[model samples]
Target: MRSFVTFASAFLVGLISFTNCTKRTSSTATQTGGGMAAEQQLAGDDLTKARANYTNFCGGCHGRSLETFVNRKWQHGDSPEALFKGIKHGYPDQGMPSYDTTFTDQEIRHLVSYIREGIVAQKGKTETKSNAAVLKSEKLNFQLDTVLTGINVPWAMAFLPNGDMLVTERSGTLYRFTKAKQLQKIEGVPEVLAQGQGGLLDVKLHPDFSKNNIIFLSYSAVKRDGGQTLSTTAIMRAKLEGNSLTNQKQIFEAQPYARTRHHYGSRIEFGRDGYLYFSMGDRGGTKVNPQNLSVHAGKTHRIKEDGSIPADNPFVNRQDAMPSIYTFGNRNAQGMALNPTTGDIWLHEHGPKGGDEVNIVKKGANYGWADVTHGIDYNGSKISDLNQKDGITDPIKIWVPSIAPSGMAFVTGDRYSGWKGSLLVGSLSFKFLSRLELDGNKVVREERLLQDIGRVRDVRLSPDGYVYIAVENPGIIYRLVPVSN
Candidate 1:
């Protein structure tokens, strides 16, 4: 049996292998392919090992359900032989290290079969689910009404006063879905470094958007320092003026931009206090940023509408702290919403292999990330020995096997019976919507909604009190209209 440490190290190396698989006219292609038929021969224990190998090695980058490759264009050939060669020889130039040294030829063949199986399974699941016009939930029967389509990677959405909708796509575009159901591109959007996991992200309308045509966008901003490209989570405040953004101002930017492209935890929400609160991931600086209050990374920050640091912030008077920081020790927090009943800012962040968490944002509180995590590293290494400490604030809810929670919203009105006060959270990994029934701050019951709904990216309540879900990979926004009882 392969040691866990060895497998984890291989997993780390395999992380970048799937980024680019463009056909290379190289001498490596001349290598003889493995017996592709052997892939189907694996059964029982061999099959189990293949699943473990892929999860421990490939799932982090490729996604758990193999949904990453669902609608993706395979730059390289999708043939079994092509997959075998790619895995065995690897594409080092394209950031994928060859796996020939790590796994036996037979093991690699089994891995290829596992991937192919997942792809086929996912395609079948998607086709069957996508064609279903109506979906049933525990409380109400509703149908998916496609409002807008063809936008790739719809990350976040906000509703305007007059029933218009604003959506931000991760590929650096802001779109306005008018009440007339026309999709119009908003101009004057900022330039974003649309790299891996970094791009135009969350968008939110100002609380007083009716009185003031203001909107906020959270994105990954790029900067060149010392001839090295660096990116960080940033916020842009702008006035929406007739399908155009004007008076655009960069209200905030996370400091010490990182080289790594992923983990730009940019989620924006306005609290009842009218303060702009947004999340910033550790920028892959897991060891340095989350525990360090002096840096903005791995923190939830609070600022005034114009982006000024608030005097009442918990760390405002501290010399060694970033004044805007409201909480610390948070991993990549992607889902944030204000609790309608308690008015508390609730957030959920992605843990490593497991331990996705839902935390209530507290002033100057530490929601321990690397220091006290229930999750282990992607490579099966322990992130922290302690899951809880005295000063660390424990999560309100924790998902052992990470669902990869994304967008979140609290059902406010009676529009959806038996679900008014429930918390609706989108699952990116499982491709479902989770509705959590809350007894005050405690989650009493949990139910899965819109199962296999194409990677639910964002869920928001429309101005007229309807649940709207945004899904990626064919990127369509659907309104969940309840049926009469």
Candidate 2:
């Protein structure tokens, strides 16, 4: 639910069978000690023929039902000769693929003897499944007012045309909330890297901002080399005056620098044609860096409020793309808006163990992550049942056991009159606040509104028509008020 950090060190246990088999051929059958005592005396039907040869050639994308490598921590190496040398020399630039001639090395040593004796004893154990499509329940007429409290892991917010409220705190501090709600913290904010899921993310506010007092952040910067450190997802351009943050500058960053903390798909919309769409996150990079076209990590760029690059974008003249790409095989897109009545442009990503999409933001599109996925492979195995292939792009809405979505908006003015254009979204793992209800771009119906109300990280809409929301454990900022019908 928007907090999975974990860099893998343990948690990978058993049960990886999804049916479908029969391939096993290529054989030179060499396995003396390297097979680790024949994977420790392979019992019962040779461990079900090494879990059916790893659910027939490595379950889809590495998942069959062992629930994706438990705690997961693979750059390659879990044992059995480091997963038989990462599946016989694969990782084809992180999209995997390399049976080094399709199995046979004794079927990749029985798929490394079923991942070291039935997937590391299936560590903590997990496999229940069935959330009925990620708990939607339904019910809405909304009302919830807290408006500012503590404030810490906030993440994103932007309203200051004078209504005050700037927030952003994945751990790099920066507050301001006041239309009397009072909360001030702002003090320059730059040096971020608040570790794991990197800090100080998103803040926006300058599409003209009452005459450019500009603003727009998105953090997690850091860079070193020698002993190696590197991080990405930058973008600053401050000058909010009053509660701090002046002159800043830095426009955009995010490239080949990453150590994997978690995707950083920042969000910072603008487009009515003034251009300035953001979003990065692919930070775990490689799967050929989201169908590579010159990385920017999974991508969803587009600039020119200052960061330039707008000569009709779309891979500008394509001398090898990356002219602020406008769409790609996105993976960790943490919500993005801009449809206050069909101005189009909407997105919502993050799937790995249960899809969770929402798409609808074309232009040079691709939208398939790790090459087509309906979601799997965190160790439950399989990552491709192909969620409608043939060129990618297809989401409208999806969300299996993952309601981990974050931040988003759309539902303009009229102080909530039957929830205007709806959209809302924000649910760091079921904290709740969905809404949806569109027709033109297709989403149909989906209620859910404010259930536990704690992890719902971001969901703005206040110029006056009210609808804030930004919750994180202790951090607050509510305001949704609109009771009756």
Candidate 3:
């Protein structure tokens, strides 16, 4: 297993803390409040067993400390009975599977006890949860500035030669952010599904946007006639004439449209090799999609700028495989960027509970996702028994208890002195920017910036070398400036 410097301390701040584990008792247990049974019986052996159980199953999603439960006010009740019921029945609609048959009532009680006593007790040992203090104490040199505000779920962005930016939202809207900090809704965008995780996603200009004036858009296109409607990620090319888009043409669409609306890996980038590359996630087809090559689901695809499959594509000659498939077995790779020096494709994907991964994508490689993973299922079940097997590429970095990585950009400009070559990865769950300092392809160190900001949806460097970011929740954009040492 690859070892990583975990941000474990960062997870503990801003939550409830306890000094004595023995006084806390679960409602489901036969013990009374602060009684002799609570101190003698439930303190030692039961907690150890509960912690072990949590690590084996729940830790992947909830973290070993049950961080998500600690950080959020529970919609389901916080009582032991409510927690036990939630754990037993599970919430399949919300990606958590039922554990009714998996664990007994006692085990579920143990989990609740662990949450109340073991996990919540670890908070406030430190004075603050603010990342500002974390950054200041670390003495990192950087400055964050708010660029634009009142935007909605800004998903992806691309810069133009004139310093203006084109951005996409998951709600089927497009906007152009000007150098003067003005926002204009671009006209003539296609109708999108805009449901669940679907909608207008990524926006990028053609590599030669200076001459062609072509902009590329990735969105969830709906196929509807009377009642039934299905949606899939599609790439469209349009001509940008001032604030309006003209000559719009869809270039590529992932095949076999599904009804599910999550996990559309729609990041697009132009490789140095002059091929247009885009990612299509597993589309919630975990068992069948990632392993199959005949379908485009859960795969990275490459095509010409005009949407034709590249003849030199990895699976072009395979009769049983889709010709556009450049690589297979990916699980929702939302972050992708070309390394500035190496020209290699670096991608970060969402794993089940804890196994978010960053991998250097190579041609025709299988990135083992339902078959092998470091994460378990949402219901605290194992997705696969093994983390590694033959023929699967291992990620260079894995974020345990997932950060929900989103947009990514390689730092290319000298405006930030020490960060010129680092990779900035946005996080939706943790609401921070992870600066990965790379030694060749391996991540040597990581610095989390702008923590507790809105969920970072996209990170892009402009032509002028300034770092621009899109933040969701209250939707806004911000720029990063270098601080002098």
Question: All candidates' TM-scores?
Answer: 0.84, 0.30, 0.77
Off by over 4 Å in 3: 1-140
| Residue-by-residue lDDT tens digits, candidate 3, 209-269 | 9999999899989997567778888999899999999999888988888776667787898
What lDDT tens digits, residue by residue, belong to model 1 across residues 280-341?
88766767889998899889999999999988999899999999999999888888999977
Q: Model 3: which ten-residue window has the lowest total lDDT?
A: 11-20
lDDT of candidates 1 onward, in order = 0.76, 0.68, 0.72
User: How many clashes in each candidate?
Assistant: 0, 20, 0
lDDT of 2 by residue, 1-485 (tens): 11111111122211122233333444554445323224554667767876765654443233453434544445555767677766665543233434545455765666576666555686654322222223223333554666666654687888877678788877788888787877888888788776556778888888777897888888879888899777789888888778788888887887778765567778888889988888787766536677887778877898886787888888888887778888888877778989867687797876664667888778888887878866664434465667777888788888765566778888876777676887888866456688888878988888886565556778888778887878664567777666554
Better of 2 and 3 by lDDT: 3
